[model samples]
Target: MRVDKYLKNSRLIKRRTMAKKACEQGRVIINEKIAKPGDEVKPGDIIEIKLGTGSTKVEVLSIKDNVAKNQSEELYKHLKGF
Candidate 1:
């Protein structure tokens, strides 16, 4: 799945546009490198997101076709390091 879409479906960013903008602005990283919105995402990939002075990091646990709000957390596993 696309990285931006994965973020929205995973409930990490809440909206696809926000996630896309984040990626375009160089705030989102895949494998420690800046990633575009169209970047492909798969299991085990590490993603880092910069939010203001704070940041979030997560490991792609499983890529889903679609996840409801209740099961969104299953999309990715949170990582301790940002």
Candidate 2:
């Protein structure tokens, strides 16, 4: 799935547009490399999102086109964050 979509579907960023903007500004990283909004994300991939002085890291656990708000956390495993 696209990184932006994954972020939104996973409820990490709350919105696809915000995720895209974050990617454009180089705030998103996957597997230690910078990620573009269209970057592909798969299970086991590491994703890090840096915002201001804090950041969040997660390991992709699954991908889906749509996810329930209550179940979004199942899409990724939190590795580290504020």
* Cα RMSD for candidates in order: 1.4, 0.6
Can you write out model 1's per-residue Cα lDDT over 1-82, one digit (the tens) per residue?
9999999999889899999999989999999899999999999999999988889899999988768899988878888644
User: Once superposed on the true structure, which residue ranges of model 2 sit more than 4 Å away at CA?
Assistant: none
- The TM-scores, one per candidate, come to 0.93, 0.97
Which of the numbered candidates is closest to the native, going by highest lDDT?
2
User: Model 1: how far is 12 from its true place, Å?
Assistant: 0.3
- Location of the lowest summed lDDT over 10 successive residues in candidate 2: 62-71
For every model in order, what is the number of clashing pairs? Answer: 0, 0
TM-score of 2: 0.97
lDDT of 2 by residue, 1-82 (tens): 8999999999999889999999999999999999999999999999999988999999999999978899999999999997
Candidate 1, lDDT over the whole model? 0.91
Backbone steric clashes in candidate 2, count: 0
Query: Cα deviation of 54 in candidate 2 (Å)?
Result: 0.7
